[model samples]
Target: MRNAPLGIFDSGVGGLTVVRAVQQLLPSEDIVYLGDTARVPYGSKSPETIRQFAHEDVRFLLDRGVKTVVVACNTATAHALPSLQERYQVPIIGVIEPGVEAVLADPQAQRVGIIATRGTVRSHAYQHALALRRTGLILHATPAPLLVPLVEEDWLDHPSTHAALHTYLDPMLDRGIDTLLLACTHYPLLVPVLSKFLPDGVRLVDSATTCAEHVKQELTKLDLLAEEEKAGKLEIHLTDLSDQFEDLSRRFLARSPGRIMRVSL
Candidate 1:
């Protein structure tokens, strides 16, 4: 089981952020990634639909012989993780808890800001997770529904993206937040753009790095860490493929993801 590939899935290519982190941390562990691009942006979908899609994605990965599953989409993690865990025998991990853990890691945090997709904000997963660990947290949660589309469109540094950031952040800034958590995996890609607008003292926490570390810890605990002396391979599967996806994925993974294949769930 230790040599079996780790499975990770997302609504779309945004989950590549998690894959990148995993690569850097567990270079010797092979990974299989599934992107439900045909139904991208699970953010606004109904919870039932998101759950169904997540299950299909998981089934696809499990069929590929993955030992563990990582729910790399914030919306799916928020909505489907519990049920997914109950149904699957393999260990499953989600992005929400790791992101909340990142926020609490900062001892000085008092007022926190969360910017995520509509479904994640609606789910209130981050708020609930944080409340369990800390009290009297002044949280500013907002749904940046447009941000995901902006990212998918490859507008990382476009003036429109900057405007959208400003429009979404101005309200949070008013509440005097000291730490901002990028609640969605895709938001990490906007860090460079987001940092430009944040106050000097405010910190940004994103799940990619923390989640990778969390997965490493889980693998260690389960004695599933790969003992191979060479680097691992990454296989990317998508529900749909396009030139735009190919280009964006290259940017996110920091290298070509080998041969990209399309599969139906």
Candidate 2:
């Protein structure tokens, strides 16, 4: 079971952030990634709707023989992670909690800001986590709904993208947040752009490095870390392969991901 590939899924290409981290951390382990590009941006959906989509995504990954699953989408993680973890016998992880834990561990944090999609912000995942563990800390949550769409459009460095980002973040700055958590996996890509606007005292926290370490620790504790050095492969599947899809994915992933095979639930 340890040698079996781990599965990672998100609503769109953003999940690649997590995959990049995992590859760096566990070079020997195999990974299978699924991006629901056809139904991208599951952020605005009702919890029930997001839960249904997450269930099917998990079933699809399990069908592909993954030993574990990681939900890399913040909206899906906020709404679907607990149910998916209970439904699947294999170990399951999602990005939100680990990220919350990471930021709370920061001794410098007094007022932490979480920037995520509408659903994640509405779900209050960060607020609740800090409230439970470190009630004294203040949680300032903001919804930057444009980041994911801009990322999917491959406009991370575009002039229009910067304008959009500025518009979104200006309000966050007014909220007096000290530390920022890029709560969405997609937001990490914009760190360079964000650095320009954020004050030096405010630190940006993203899930990749910490999440990768946590996954390794969990797998080790479960005795599920792969021992084989087999040439682990990457297989990317999307629900719909738009012309824009491959082009954007190529730009986002920095290479043609073999083939973005189309599949369905």
Candidate 3:
């Protein structure tokens, strides 16, 4: 079981951020990544639909014999994590709780701002988790649905992307948030652009990185950590494929995603 690959799925290439983090942290563990590009932008889907899609995604990964599953999509994690955990016997992790834990780690994160997809914002997963963990936390969350398309389009430095970011974050800035939790995996790619505009003291908590850390911790606790010394392998699967998706995958992974296969999930 230690040699089994880690399973991760997302609505699209955005989840590659989680894959990249996992690869960096746990170099010896193999990974199987499924990008549901055919149903990209799950943020607009209904809660019931999101849960159904999540179940299918997990089933696909489990079929591939993964040791664990990571719900790298923020919207799916928000809407379907509990159900996924209940339905799957393997250890299933999601991006939301790890992000909330990251926020609570900082004693100074009194007023925090969250920017995620519409579905994730609607789910209130982050807010609810933080409320359960600690008290007196002032939270502001907004849906930045535009940023996902912008990032997927590779418009990290585009003026329109900056304008959209300002439009989403300006209100949070006005509220004097000390920490900004990037609830979506796709948002980490915008860190450079975000740093250029955010104030000096505002901290950024990236869910992808935190989720990877949490995965490592959980695997260790479960005695499932791979004991190999060599670098791990990665497998890329997508429900749909396109030239744009190929390019976006490369950008998200910071390297060539070799031999991407199209699968019907």
Candidate 4:
């Protein structure tokens, strides 16, 4: 089982951030990534529908003989993680707990700000998880529904993207948040632009990096870490092939996403 590929799924290409992180940290572990692009934007779906979609996504990955599964979509992690965990024997990890851990990792982190999609913010998954872990920790979660489309459009440095960031994040900054948690997988791509505006004292916690670290730790404990001497391979599967898949995959993965295949659930 240790030699089997790791499974990761998201509503779209955003989960490639997690894949990139794993590739950097665990270079020997092969990966199987599924992007449910046919029915993307799971952030807008009902909880019941999200759970159902998540089940099917997991089934597809399991069919490929993955050692463990990572729920890379924030909305799906929020709505479907527990149930998925209950149904599957594989060690299923979600982005929310890892994100909360990253925020709490800073001993001085108080007044944390979270920016995610409408479904994730509405679910209060990060908020609730943080509250359980730390007392007297203040959290403000804002739903930035516009940023996803901006990211998909590859507007990483466009003026409109910068304007949207300011519009969404200025209020949190004004409230004196000590740390800003990028709760969604796509938000990490905005780090350069975010750094241009954020104060030096404010910390940025990226869920993608944190989740990757957490996966490393968990794999170590589970004795699932692959041999370090061997190089890893990445395979990307999308439910629908969009015209922008190649470009967006490169943007998200920071390299050519080799041989992307389209599959139906």
Candidate 5:
């Protein structure tokens, strides 16, 4: 199974952050990525709907022969992971758990701020995950649904973006949150702009990056890390062609994002 390509999926181009991390960590492994651009922003949908969509996504990837699946979108992680796990045989990794694990492990972590979509924050997934165990950690969650559209527009460095980000974070920063979680995959692209508004002491955590690290370890343990000779080939499947799925993804992934095969639900 080491030669089997890993499957990664996101609501849109945001998951490219996870793909970028995967590329850096496991350069030899081929990946099959799917961006559900037609149904972008799973944050606002119901759990049943999200779960159904996620199942279709998993089925799509499984049809292509993946050894593992990476859930790169926070919204789907909150609402869809459980059902996906029940239906899929391969190992499954989601963005939330690994991110929370990182925050809990930080020695200096006192208060952690999470910036995510409205649905993610409302689900209280992170808070519930951290609350199950006593870790003496304070959680500050902010829902910034607008950022998703802004990131899609490639407006990460826009002055307006800085204002919105500052509005969401300044309160948490003032409350002494030393670590900030980029709860949404797309948020990482705005890290540079976020840093300008945030205090120097604050650190931005990429859940996708941490998730990739955990995924690599899991794949290695399972003897599924594809060799170098088997790489340089990738498959991209999309639910639809709207939202400039190809163009925006290219900017975020830093590649042309070749072979975006389209599929209907």
Candidate 6:
């Protein structure tokens, strides 16, 4: 089981952030990443639909022989994690809990700002998770659904992106949040642009990085860490393949994903 690949799935290309983190930290552990590009945005979907999609994703990964599954999509994590875990024998991890741990780690974060997709905000997953660990938390949640398409378009630093950021984040900034949580995996791609807009004292908390840390911890605790002396391989599966997604792969992995397989999920 130690040598079996770690499975990761997201609603779309955004989950690559989690992939990058896992690869960086656990170089010897193989990975299988599936991006449901055909149904890119799960944020607007109903909970039942999201849960169904997530179940299919888990089945696809499990069929490929993964020992663990990481639900990298915040929306799916919010609504589908419990069902996925209940039905599957493999251990499952979600993005929300790891992100909540990150926020609580910072003592200076009295007022924390959360920016994610419409569904994630509507589900109140982050808010609920944080409430369990902390008391009297001042939280501001905002939905920046536009950012996903912008990042997919590779408009990481466009003037239009700045305008959108201003509109989505201005209220959170006004709340004097010392820490801002990038709740969506795709938002990490805009960190350079997003950081520029943040006040000097406010720190950006990237859930992907923290989630990856949690992955490492979990694997280590279960004695599932790969023992291979050399770097592990990465296999990417997309529901639909395209030049744009191929192009974005470079941005996500710092190189080509190397032989991507287009599969319908």
Task: Give residue 234's lDDT in candidate 1 (0 to 100).
Answer: 92
Which run of 10 residues does model 1 get worst, by summed lDDT? 190-199
Q: What lDDT would each prediction earn against the true structure? A: 0.91, 0.83, 0.94, 0.94, 0.85, 0.91
Worst 10 residues of 2 by lDDT: 248-257
**Per-residue alpha-carbon lDDT of model 2 for 103-167, expressed as tens digits?**
87787788887788888899987788778888688777878887777887768789888887777
Q: Which stretches of candidate 5 lie over 4 Å from their true place?
A: none
Better of 1 and 2 by TM-score: 1
> How does each model score on TM-score?
0.97, 0.93, 0.98, 0.98, 0.95, 0.98
lDDT of 1 at 79: 96
Compare candidates 2 and 3 on lDDT and give the better one. Answer: 3
Each model's backbone clash number: 0, 0, 0, 0, 0, 0
Error (Å) of candidate 1 at residue 77 is 0.6
Model 1 spans > 4 angstroms off? none
| Cα lDDT tens digits for candidate 5, 14-109 | 888899888888888889999898897798899888888888888888888999999999989999898788877899899999998877776787
In the range 1-265, model 4's lDDT, one tens digit per residue, is: 9999999999999999999999999999999999999999999899999999999999999999999999999999999999999999999999999999889989999899999999999999999999999999988899998898899888889989989888888999999999999999999998898888799899999999999999999999999998566989899999999669888999999998989999999
Cα-based lDDT at residue 196, candidate 1 = 81
Per-residue CA lDDT of model 3 for 1-265, tens digit only, reads 9999999999999999999999999999999999999998898999999999999999999999999999999999989999999988999999998999899999878999999988899998999999888899999999998998899888999999999999999999999999999999999999999998899999999999999999999999999999888789999999999999999999999999988999998
Residue pairs clashing in model 3 are none
Error of 4 at 222 (Å): 0.3
- Alpha-carbon RMSD of each model: 1.0, 1.7, 0.8, 0.9, 1.5, 0.9
